[model samples]
Target chain A: MTGPLQQVLGKAAEFGGTALAKLQHTHVPGVGQASTTEPREVAAARWRAVTVFRDDLAGPFPELEALGPDLEVRMQPAPGDRGTELSARFHGTPTDEQVGELRAALRRTKQLAEVGEVLRVDPQPHGTRKATLQGAALEGAAARAPKEGVL
Target chain B: MKAAIWAGVNEVAVEEVDEPQLLNDHDVILKISKTVTCGSDLHLIGGYIPAMRAGDVLGHEFTGTVVERGKAVTKVQVGDRVVVPSFIACGHCWYCSQELYSLCDNGNPNPGITEGLWGQSPGGCFGYSHAMGGFAGSHAEYMRVPYADVGCFVVPDAVSDTRALFASDSVTTGWTGAHLGGTKPGDVVAVWGAGAVGQMAARAAILLGAEQVVVIDRLPERLAQVRQHIGAEAVDYSTTDVVAELRERTGGRGPDVCIEAVGMEAHSTGIQGAFDQVKQQLRLQTDRPSAVREAIRACRKGGSVFVLGVFAGPVDKFPLGAAMNKGLTVRGAQQHGQRYVPEILAHMESGALTTEHLATHTMPLSQAAEGYRIFKEKEDGCVRTVFEPGG
Candidate 1:
């Protein structure tokens, strides 16, 4: 049975995977090897994901509300576009819970991308593929969350 | 030679004041080479400081040559160029031995006051009031220096008279202000006032690694000097709203440290001005709370506000509640010359701190009255006026 912290991490990793896939298509410039042919759809999805994520994190998060207005979080292309980036600027006081969640999400996102490579099997059924992706995302998230009863 | 005698309120004359003769076993009689009129002297002349009389020789900060010394005086011999610390502290006293000479219990000549720290009758000062031990001041051609071995420091050969003269008081005071204020690397510091001490404080702040320094003052030339030469952001409090401007510049948090270098008699227009003047007249207000108010308002929460300026009377309406709410710390005292003078001299020797720029006027001691008038009026960019008493 997964705990609440695990559950949050799992959801965050799934978001990371979807965001990473879209990021690869819009950003990865090299031809053939692993490129998205449908540029318009990829761009639209990237925009939608970024907008949604930004809005979700923009409002007063009870954990980070005290860190003041200097708190800034944004998504950017990782230095070698193969990875995604999440940057946060903290100025004032912030709770331990807020800091922990932010760190966990960032770490889990990177782990999900690493595990996605192993599950890239060819011609799998769409339902099976979705399940595999969900399993990999859950495993990544679980690994990043702190142990139960520990910070 | 006659000395200018301070008889009463607005009454001073070049009268035949007694020439100082060595009284103590460790005393040295100095032929005053240069004696700069200080802002505090104005308070004495205006009859603000009680116990001042007709014959009180009046200058505290000066450099001179030791013309004569008692048999016990060994460290500084006759004819040596020396700069006297404002206070006469016995070298062997517990406080002087600890380098906290300003609080020396044995050094102060007055028996009524418990040390010279505060609220006590003034300790003995050169040319200050009778309450301050009635010691003759440096304003005359020749004056006596007690505790010559401890109170006088040898001026290094490398430092010029024009630059090194302020080492006696203003420069050391400024250094002490910034040092005690906890000025550190990458600190956003705002210094109030662009007078000699204020400029020195800004310079010290920069040397101590304040990443951003802001100097606030009314005079344009002083402000310009602070901006261009001292490398600080100059704010004209005359025109700009200082509290709001500082907040905006410091990301709505305000400076990490604010220094009230303006001292007791900062004349600003409006409600603050009325309060300051009233406080001065009342004698209940010693610390300039207006400057303190501005410093408190302009400091980031948990920052420090340093009061280097002199306050004569009691302080009314201190914002202790606001200071507590903000978790801010405030600390100030008279300069500890013994602690910092050697280091300041070292810096001067190394060419790191040059005070020549602050000395805007240099005249013979005969023109001392005019120099005082100009300094009081703060006219024509007169930041520091050095008087050559020998001339």
Candidate 2:
């Protein structure tokens, strides 16, 4: 029974991640992503970027560089002394999972360059999770959070 | 370890939970001394925020002794008594450099949830919700604090835990409103809602050299507290017209600054109140925002209005036209506690700021559910209930 439950939760976590990705692209009436719905190729073709606070950001950013040889990475000084703008995109259209990896890599690059260590929250503490479906879904959403966002 | 958990919507319970551990190089573990229920926590408790999961820990404002430290934590040592801001921020972020710690880009790990609701996400808050950060709250006996050197401030030796605890959220949040609302010397400031945050806002205005500060609230107990503890004039909005009264007191020019400390669930007496309640219940609007409406209407032309409240989403009848036509500089943000904690501690040390009055009830962690109950219902004049997790 425990094995089955774990398997179900694992699947739920995957679903949660996919749902979040869809949520970003989906248009809601009053609120949603700033961009309108676009072709998948158009969405994936755009460069994803985050600005690091260090003005002297010269990157051998291990996180983004690790993606592959096909990934195009760029760095430039941001305006008004904000710091460096680091951006990346694949040579061709990438899968949702690939986009998710890029997002996570960009965030980690910023964290590592600025704070020197990525912040962590898990293995902290919690009361008993009641094994409810919504609880599992939320757990899944949180697991995918490092990779999902406007960035 | 015993901690308060959000059992369900409008439900809280005390449960034995796993103790926290240092999860990162910059993290520190705290033996929580005192953790208090905040008005903002009510939104999470009532399912208004919609990100809270059952069994999630419930607290943000707390004072504690650092019991353990990670390698990267240097500013605070083990056994140092400290108060952490509700928001989690890495000191290295651009927003943190700008002293806008609440808008730190790296704080909220679960940005997708918030970015989906709000166009952009702010910093993470403890025990608020997963959308802010799934970080466990301070209600437990021991809790982990990330970015210790950035977020934790040592409580001054002269300040007791009870007095210093409010600095974690209320005083800092209030200071954010008064300071950013641009209250200058000789300015007349009007603060709506005399809850802990509202009272603190009014007090901050006074300390910032506001010529006159008035706090408006419907609750007699909170209003009286504003007068007695905060040393600010109190108005019973239930009994009087708030805008007219503020205008009258400000010599018909209206207040130079208006701060709305009442969040989504603002109370009003007449048709507007009924309409807001109905709309909220019917899911037509996510927030009530009656105090905001009043603040904008009452603010002097070209004056400033700052919202310190924790509103989740859009409200009906917002009076944006009044805000625009009046040329009001309207701004709102979560409390940037990191920017103001040092000054607040200094004020606390000097006995210039008194916050012990806000902790009207103190009890063991076992009573947190009941504590939240009395606080939410405003029963027995309970302003805030401080829970001693160690006890």
Candidate 3:
């Protein structure tokens, strides 16, 4: 464990025993009462990260080896998709924020590799693809918007 | 940049809008030279499509000089003349890999809308409607093309600007209809609507060695073009019972292939049209399938029914029973343009296809609204109205 996330969780554990002891039987607004103590498999899941890529986010699994020496980054085919899913078992459990940040980092790497940056639609060119709905366009209208252009 | 914005139903305006910047690696910006008004555009302008936003830039069929290209673009270079099809296809999707470019998975950025309606989304289109992936339109001084390598095709020097322009949408769409319909040697093909698409479909079938091609339309000029330019038979559906005439002409076997290039806003003669108009007015059926209706009934048993028309909503009385029981093969589609642009361009260069006569009027971009008005009203026998952005 390293950085502020490590320190925050460490300090909480030192003061309240285990991290789960700090927030036992927590109440979530919409989800109702949440069990602070989860099953062993669910607890083990916190340290793992799964990211789905629509376009090819995966190139080489270079980052997976950095988690630990014995950590085997299991590469598997994502269900019902052609994308590759990579998972790594960390040596130490990571905080929820750390897992989210890790997922975002993976996504950012994908954006850099595939699109050169996160793809943006703004500064939308005068003529590009449109993504809106109206009229009979919804029911059965084929792509016959109009000939506002000149040949 | 000044652009023709879809301000309201049947309304257009030349408004000063932001110059589109190259936003992606494979993007290209075109200094638009020419654009043409198409028959389908009338659906949006007349408010039949009803998806146009107040400030949406309208216009899609265009040919322009490439002014800039994104980092990943390699096929097209700056200063080259290029024509892009209206439909947007990302070359890497499973759908595109299968050569069904129109049904590209990544084409429509907002897939939920189309998914709810069609159960699956089609590829995006430029300057089409928001329902089409509302890319700003090509009616401006500059237009941006995403997946530039996939959609942009270079226009040969031999193909004149006017000739190359229709290749973007109208010609390609017509070509798609004919090509996908499997037009074969000695086939007797019947096409509905003698407009741009119909003309091209007839010509394509002729080129594909069809023995006879019959084009049906109400307009005299469009039918005249079918006879004179296309060298195909014309059926004045307004004067004759289209199904009966087609059957009689085809020696009771009907045409071997019936192509429906006329789209959602179809009209019929007499009582059927009256019934459709009433049903349409009451919001019961969004599509008037007279052209499609007649086409199915007119096609021979075991013949192929190719539908190149655009039907947005459901129709009440589709002749599915005839199609099913008669062993008629019904295939309708938006243009899978990426699959056909190469051959179509080759045809254009080889002089087998000449589309220059289709552009009946040309106006400066500043007067784009007037061009659309002429198109909407069909004044001056305007089959197509071209606009010059630099003018």
Candidate 4:
């Protein structure tokens, strides 16, 4: 690939990764899953949570505690005995990177509690990675998937 | 090890790839015995699902012998002949606890891709796409299976590999549609697409005590298989109007349950068909929902419609008004195989559910490109091409 082509493909891959994360926060009429029209501040202010399937969720939650003292973590019994609702939010305005970190931390905490190990997908069997723009974009999206989502 | 992979759009090839290892304590490695093509795989191959990249491994419905085991995997053992479900699920999740394994929270490691598209991610599926999970598929000689105790079921001693193989996906998926669509005694059931999933769906309805079942398709070979092997009535939509024919067969009340096994690439006739084809090709709509539209229209008032096909995104010309007016219950999902595989295997053992006929063509993994060509083109009466990776 030429230098210009390589640069364009690299940008496309980056766009693929960030665009997915952007969609979670953007409410597109009839096109996106995000139903929220809240401002960025309000969306970030709200508690992000996962319903853990365990009734007895005690902590020493190392995942949340590692997020620093500025984060407030809480847990409550979920309705109908579904499990505990583990939630967290920043004390002050947080950057998008901080929010992404929180999301990844919460997911890892849930996985470690439920499945005993964080699930891995990389280093698995796969063929050549063609240098096409679409393939590169998808590769970027998969790379950023764990740290990006409604979580 | 040799495996089939998606090289590019409408391109498939056999390549030597690295073998999978135990990624999680609950995972196991399987030396795959039999893996077959599914209608859903065509969506990935054709690039209709945007998440698939080139060189992604491609088979999912499979049976294999457990070659290695993780330390925490207590129930399943090495050397166990098992048929693994395509959707990987953490057995103890709330959704898995509720028998909705496909909706598992812990399955998809890469949740953002699907969460962005569908609001929430379901479970991860082997070899489907990154939107589901980036797990390697079973088309290879050996593959890793996560959550083995929940997803892998030991094949019965009496059941052969071919028979037990369909139980992994086709039969279980069919049973999911029939059982969840609320098929009951004396009800008339109509299935769209006389492919393997459609045939199996009709058979499942019959086993569930439906008094009448009819399968609709354009292929004469598949229709013949429906009547001969599945023991159900067949409707050739090429010659007859499916809605009118179904109504006439059911005494004008229409079918009590309508199941669509045709996925995003459904075939139709006249202007509607041309319209869908053009829209899909132009990237206006992500899927062709001709079968779903027909099902909703043909279903009786207060009837239930279950979608057994795999649809990626939105479709144009959906029959929402008809569904609302008729009080139809429309539901669709990726198959929750863990919930239904046991009963399907039992049925297979008794010869009550015959799925070996669905594997119309069998070949070595090296002929994967040709196999997919025949299966996709529907030439040579190839309902499915079962790949023997080790051969």
Per-model DockQ against the true two-chain complex: 0.00, 0.70, 0.08, 0.79
Estimate, for each residue in B1-391, the C-alpha lDDT of model 2 and write its tens digit. 9999998889899999988888889999999999999999998998888777899999999999999999988898999999999999998888999999999998987887787667678999999989898889989899899999999999989899999999999999999999999999999999999989999999999999999999999889898898889889999988999889988998899999999999998889899999999999998998989999999999999999999999987788989899999999999989999999999999999998999999999999999999999999999999999999977
Clashing pairs in 1: B57-B127, B58-B127, B127-B137, B284-B314, B285-B313, B285-B314, B285-B315, B286-B313, B286-B314, B286-B315
**Which parts of model 3 are misplaced by more than 4 Å?**
A1-119, A125-151
lDDT of 4 by residue, B1-391 (tens): 9989999989999899999998888999999999999999999998898888888899899999999999999999999999988899998878999999999999998998888887888999999999999889989999999999999999999999999999888888888999899999999999998888899999999999999999999899999999999889999999999999999999999999999999999999999999999999999888999999999999999999999899977889888999999999999888899999888888888988878889999999999999999999888999999999877
The prediction achieving the highest DockQ against the true structure is 4
TM-score of chain A of each: 0.26, 0.90, 0.38, 0.89
Better of 3 and 4 by TM-score: 4
Model 2 docking tier (incorrect/acceptable/medium/high) = medium
Best by TM-score: 4
True contacts kept of each: 0.00, 0.69, 0.13, 0.80
Ranking by TM-score: 4, 2, 3, 1
The lDDT of each candidate is 0.64, 0.90, 0.74, 0.90
lDDT of 3 by residue, A1-151 (tens): 4777555544543442222222223353212134466764566454343433343555564444343464445556666664555455544555543443344344333334433544345556342222233322322222211111000
Distance from true location, Cα of A65 in model 2, Å: 2.4
Q: Can you tell me which runs of candidate 1 are displaced by over 4 Å?
A: A1-151, B113-123, B278-288
Cα misplacement distance, residue A83 of candidate 2 (Å): 0.3
Backbone atom clashes (below 3 Å) for every candidate: 10, 0, 28, 0
